[model samples]
Structure formats: structure tokens, C-alpha cells
Target: MPPTRPHPRLRYQILREQSPSWKTMGTIAGVIFLTTTPLIRPRGLVGRFPNLHCPSSKFSHCRTTANTATDAPPFQVSAAASSPSSAIDEEKEVTSSGNVGADDLLIVGPGVLGRLVAQKWREEHPGCQIHGQTVTADHHEELNEEGINPCLKGTKTTHKFPYVIFCAPPSRTSDYSADVRMAALNWNGEGSFLFTSSSAPYDCNNNGSCDEDTSVVPIGRNPRTDVLLKAEEVVLEFGGVVLRLAALYTSFMKVDAASLSVAILKKRLRNQILLGCDNHPLSRQEVMDLVTKSGKFSETFEAFTGTNDPLGKRLNNSKTREEIGWEPKYPSFAHFLESL
Candidate 1:
């Protein structure tokens, strides 16, 4: 009637098909895009996307910038974590504190080497206490004269020593391991325990080089070897050190030379002589010749043999030298003889 409005269906169809103005269309499109697409605001978005950067204008008024706020803390590294060798060096420094000191020594058997060690300790550390154990009563006065307190066998000691050196040879009747255990009972775990063992544990008959890490030759059924090995075990159990000495010789002990000369003398005099095959064999004429040439009642000769001897490998002391920084005063038999 008034403004004959087009039919309602026709009006709806015209509005749907008609294009809107540019500004109106742009506003409508922007509203739909914002709702559908994510609103990437710089404020909370920094935490979600840590690696991403925000525009300077977006956070210009913010107190903490995204780059400064999201920076990682500095890393801290430890000495042990950085180098394993440094850790080992520190451990060695700690363990090396067990080195021998004045007033800390106890010698089980104050024999030649024991006396030497005691003398050296006295010379180095004057007025320091050093105790020695001996089976012989006669050695008491001598040991006292040399400034060492002598302890008789089977004597009980109320004092605990920091260093114990066992120089006793393996006994014929007593258990060597028991002896070592008894001696080790004196240690308070504050210092080192050293045992003077023989290189016999390592047989050169096999013609192989041996070190501290080498496997010891089997003792088989030999009771003596078994006892020695047991003694070594007892020492090692106590965290002790074993010094496998070679054929020990000194200026005083002429056992090696005296025994040979005594054998020759008994044989030459037509006297009954008990000889072991371990002695160097010599013809009767050779013995006579030695006696005649020397013209002395007693003659001493070193057994110099060719390389044919299977037991010729020298005892290696590299472990002692490197570990304990020890060096022999007399390095060789000849040096010992020359010194004498």
C-alpha cells in the first residue's frame, strides 16, 4: 500500500546478490578473519614460542624484553666432571699421605735390611722412636746400642704402629701367614704395611718377563711355596705392599760364596761332604786348581755362567721405583761386591 514493498522473498534475494561498499566489506572480512585465525599477541606468545622473536614496537613499553627475559642461565661444570685424570691425581695425592714418617716404624725382623732401614730412619729423623722385633736374645743389647727398642718374640705390645715392615724369612715349622697376621694386628690403618718377599714366587724357569701385575707361577705341591703365597695373601688382605726381592746379598752375608768354598774344601780333603745339586758343579781337578791358585785356606768365587741358563731373567722393580720412588743403593751384585 504506502510504499508497495517488494515481495519479501524478492527482497531477500536482492540483498543476498548485491555487492556491499568497499569499507563495509573490509570491516566484515576483518572481523571474521580475527575470530577464525589465532590472535598472536606478543605478551603471552613469548613463553609459548621461546625461539621466536617479537617486533620491537609490540613490547616497547614492557619492562622486560622478550630476548632478555627468555635468555638461558649460564652452565656450571665441576672439576671431576671435566677431567677424569684430575680426579685420579687428587686420589693419588690423598693416598700418598701414607708414606713412612719418623716415630712410625716397626721392624718385625731386625736383620741386615732392617738394621739399615732403622739406621737410615734414625739418621733422617733424630730422636724418633723405632721398635724392632727379634727372636734372638743376644740381638737385644745390639739393637739397644743402635738406638732401637728391641721387642722379643711372643712379647705383647700395647702400642699401635703406623708403619710395619716384615723382614722375617719363612719359618720351617711355623705358619708364615699366621706370622703376618699377627704382625698386621699392630697396624691402625693409618700408614703403610710392607713385606719383604722373595722373587721365588715368580719362576724364571718359564723364561718370561714378570711385573707386579703378572700371574704368579703355581706352587704345585711345594709346602714352602704354599706358605709364602699364603703370607703374601695375608699381607695383601691388609692393604699391604709386597716387595719381591731378588737374591739378596750384602757385604757381610757370604753364604753364597762361603757355602761353595766349603763344599770344595770338604771334597778336596777327601772328607764326606753333603752337597745339593743347587750348588754350582765343579770337577775335582778344578777345585784343586782353584785352591792351589788362590793359596788361601778359603776361596770365594762368583758363579759366572753363560746365557744357556733358563733362569736368567732379572727381577723387575719398576713398580717399586715408580710407585714408591725407591732406588737400590747397590743396584747389582757387582756393585755390592765393589762397595765391600
Candidate 2:
């Protein structure tokens, strides 16, 4: 045999060298071990060196992330005193596209519904403060375009802008209470908190005309209803406006409508007949006439839930009209469906 070659370990060392994260970590750990070796007392002398564990190279990234996280979040922050008024001042410059009201207005809600409502208000009063809230990220661009600043979820603090509309819907049926308390919070307790409860809150039967003063009966233990009631309770206690909208209909019905196309969505009337087919709650022709055409339709028709139950005949919105000057400028159910 030739002269004895070096061991395989020596050949491996000379054959190749490679570097990766683990390799770097190992090298650092070795360096630390070398530097601290002198400080390490013998187990016998120290009684036990179990207290001095190996320095782990794996912690490099953990240490780096920990240090970096100490920095602030990525958002503009102003002191409490300057935040609200500055925002208002900034809005005044940009929101001239519409007529604002004498009293500042703030609307709390999300989705296209919120945007359209803000636009509706702007169209009505260009000077009113049209503050909007968006629960989703993708919606921010559209909201900004509408001159409606977005509120980060669970991060909005009330500024008392004279009017705060609780336009937020309850969480999906899976978990209605998930967002129920949000209504209670945005009220801010300083101004009029407009709680948009549902016409469903009124138990409408076939026999009588439901009015605002009608005593409400507990229909069921539905969380959506409970939240609306809770929100209304909270808002009303503070002298805010409680508008129990009855199938919101106006010229711009597409923006904020319960049903988009009465023709296609007529299937929804399946349950309405259970109350009583005698009452037709269609809103298409009325919606069409108000937004597109006009002056051709005649008469206001009421949508009835078709129930003879004494507890179910209380779904009228006369109070909204009597209290506020706002009126439904569209068709009654019979007039709307007749067109369809």
C-alpha cells in the first residue's frame, strides 16, 4: 500500500467547503464556546454546571425579530387633541364635492352600503362631515375615492360630530353577536347616534296598520333582532335618533336596498305569503320610477307581512316621518310589484 493516507475526516475537510445558515450558526456557537470556555467552571468545582446551558445559534433570528418588533406600528399617529379636528379640517378641503350640513355628521358602517349612504348624504348636503368605516382592507381605496376616511376595525374613537349613524349590519347568522357591541361603542355618547333598526322589529300581521307607537312583541330570540334592539336602546337612552327603516326606498335605491331586483328576487316572497298573500311587498316599479323614470306612477302601497296575529301588526314608519323631515320618495309595495 502507499504511505498511509490521512483519515477520511481530513480528506472531507480538504475536499469541499460549504456555507449555509446552520453552518454559520455552528461557527458562531463554536466561537462563543471558545471565548467562554475559561469562564466555565468544572462541574465538581461549581457543584453543578447544569445552570450554564449551551448557547444556541438558533436564537439569532429570534433575537433580531424581537429587537425589530420594538419599533412602532406603520400608521400615522397624532396626539389626541389634534387628531379629530385635523381630520375634520382635512376633510373640509376635500369634501367640497357635496353640501355638508350645519352640524358635523359622522357615519359608522362598512361595505358598499356605507359608501353609497355617505355619497347620498354628500349629494344632499355637501358640507356634512361624511365619516365612514370599512371593516375590510380592499374597501379602503373606494372609500378614499368617496372622500370617506376608513376606521380600522375595533379602532374607532367617537368624535361627536352631531350625527353618528349606526349603519353596520349584524355579523352573519353564524355569529350575530360578534359585532353587536360595536353599535354600543360608536355612539360615543356625545351626539345623536342614529340607530337604523329593522322593519322586521315590528310584528306585522294582516289586520291593522302598524304605527310607531304600537307595542312591540318579542318575535323570537334572534341575535340580529336582539342586537338592533340593544343598539336602539343604547342610542335612544342618549337622546339619539332611532330610525326603524321600512324597506329603505328612494331615488338611489340601488345603493342601499334590501333587494336589488324585485323580479328576480321575488322568490324571497315565499315566507311573505305565509303571513298572508293578500299583502304584496314588491318595490321594483317604485324603485325604477324614482331613479330612472318618474311622474307616471300613482299611489303609495304598504308591504304587509300577511299575518293575522295580534302581535304582528306593528310595522309602520309614521314615527320616522313625524320626527324627522325624511320621507320615502319611492313606490309602495303594490305599486312596485304591479310594474314587475
Candidate 3:
């Protein structure tokens, strides 16, 4: 007549289906058992549920003895233990290759940009050797004054540097590619070799943005562009880096008030002056007319000559900044001019 009780096995089945806390309690019990019995290996049990391995060394005793997930104890199961071996390998590689120290840099040309680079490098890395190479002996005294060791090309030297930066202009060298090859030969493939080039090789008429992956379409048979491309090819062949610079300006080249006045006076004698209108977004004729009508140039201009290259696109240095983590000290020519 009284209500009949459910079977014990049926009650357990109801509990298993209705509550998840029992499973959590089972896991906690397993962990407690594993922690208390250190001598008993849990490899067989751990091998059944491989996902339970510990994530890092901070948790559990698994950090000391666990090399594989199956060998780790129940208490040691975390996310760190389940990480792939490739991550460990990459860390080792970085540790071995990314060790650059003092006395590791050499600059091929110590001209305006080169000198600025040297000064900046010295500021970042004190007590480092910075050797500057110059073709002419005239710059020797000046280089020495700047605390840069002047080295002439083809001079015998036993010193091998880890980093080589070629700042030489293509116009100055007879064969720019040859110069780059010579610099690469000096490098034993230990560190990076960086060559400064120009963006003239790329014609950005179609696409305004030009990056490292941009295809180069030279406008015509330009010797300077050909030489720069050749040098870039040589650098790339040696797994080196090429930095294509936009127009460079420095405040140090600023003329004094007296010198500027003298220059303007001397310029009055010239019948015509060349103007680079490639940076402006107007037609040559329009720019010429604007220059002629302008009060300052009305007295001096008989005719204005403009560059053939059209201007609209800008050099996209996104790749350069992303790769080398370098940002321009002077973002624009106007900024550099204003600094003077």
C-alpha cells in the first residue's frame, strides 16, 4: 500500500543523468589520489584522457618529470603540457640566431644619411665599433672628427662584421651591383646585409601604393634605374635586405641668411632654372604657368623646365616599417626644412 522505492542502480542512473557535480567530484578524487601516491605512475590512466595535461610549469609537480602527456600524472594535467613541440623549437632558434652584440656593424658609405645612421646607432649601442668607408681621402679627417673609423675600399682587413649597411649612392659608384657583391662576399652569412636603394625603379602610375612586393616597371632606358635594380638583385640573391628610400633631406645642409642672399643674387644671372614638378599633382604646363604668374618667379623666369615624370603616388614604406621596425626621424622634406 506504501509508495515503492526506486532500485539503487536506477537511482545511480538518475543521479548520473541529472547532475554533473558527481563527475567533477570523481575528477577531484582522482587528482587527490595521484597527488598522494607519488611513486605510482599514472601513465596508463593519463594516456586514456590526454587532454587533461597541465598548461604550464607553475601548476603541479608535472613540470619536473612530465615530458609526454601520457607520462604526466592526473594532478599535473594542464594546457601547457599539451602544447606542440614546434613552439619550443622556434624559441630555441631565436635564442641561437638573434644574438647581436657590440662591434658588430659596418657602414659602406658615411655620407649624410650614413653619418646620421652612425650617430643614431651609437646612441642606441654605446661602445660598439662603427667603421665607415669612403672612396676619397678628403673625408678622412672629417670622419675621424666624428669618431668614425674611416676605411678605404679594397684595403686589406681581417675584421669581419656581423651587420653591413651599404649607404653608397649609385651615382657615385661605377658599378653599383659590383659594389654590393663585394660587400656580400665579406659577409659570412651570419647577419643581415642592408643596401639603400631608390624607389625610381618602380612606376606607380597604375597603383598609388608601392610596397616591397610591388612589381617594377621602369618607364624607359634609364641607366640610374638599371644600376639600382641590379644592386637590389645582388642584395636579394645573398638573402640581404634592400631599403628603398624616398627623397632625403637634412637640416645640417641649411644655408645661412647671408649665403642664401648670395645664392639668390647669383641665380639672377641664369636665364632658365630647372624645377622638379614631379612632386606636384598638376600638369607641367599648368605648373609652368603658375610659376610664371607668381610674383617671386616673374622676374627670373623666361621659361620653366619641368621633370617628365608625373607625380601622384607616394612610396609605401609599410613593409619596411613592419620588417625592420624603423620609422623616419623626419617624415617629410618640409619637416626637415622647418627644423633648420
The sequence of per-residue lDDT tens digits that candidate 2 reaches over residues 1-340 is 2222111111000001122311111111000000011111112111110111112100011101111111322232222323232233222212223443444445556444444455555655565566665444566666666667665444434232434555666652232233333433333333344445554555444324555554444635655566566655554344444445443322213222322211111111110101011122322222222322333323332222121112223233433333332333234433333333
Please state the error at residue 127 of candidate 2 in Å. Answer: 4.2
Off by over 4 Å in 2: 1-102, 156-158, 172-191, 206-208, 219-224, 248-315, 333-340
Query: Mind sharing the TM-score for model 2?
Result: 0.47
- For residues 217-316, write the lDDT of model 1, one tens digit per residue: 5767556667777887776666555555443322112122222222221121110111111112222123223333433323333221112212223334
TM-score, model 1 to reference: 0.52
Q: Which segments of model 3 are wrong by more than 4 Å?
A: 1-102, 218-221, 250-304, 332-340
The pairs that clash in candidate 1 are none
Ranking by lDDT: 1, 3, 2
TM-score of each: 0.52, 0.47, 0.52
Instruction: State the lDDT at 11 in candidate 3.
Output: 9
Error of model 2, residue 245, in angstroms:
2.1
Per-candidate clashes come to: 0, 17, 9
* Lowest-sum lDDT 10-residue window in model 3: 28-37
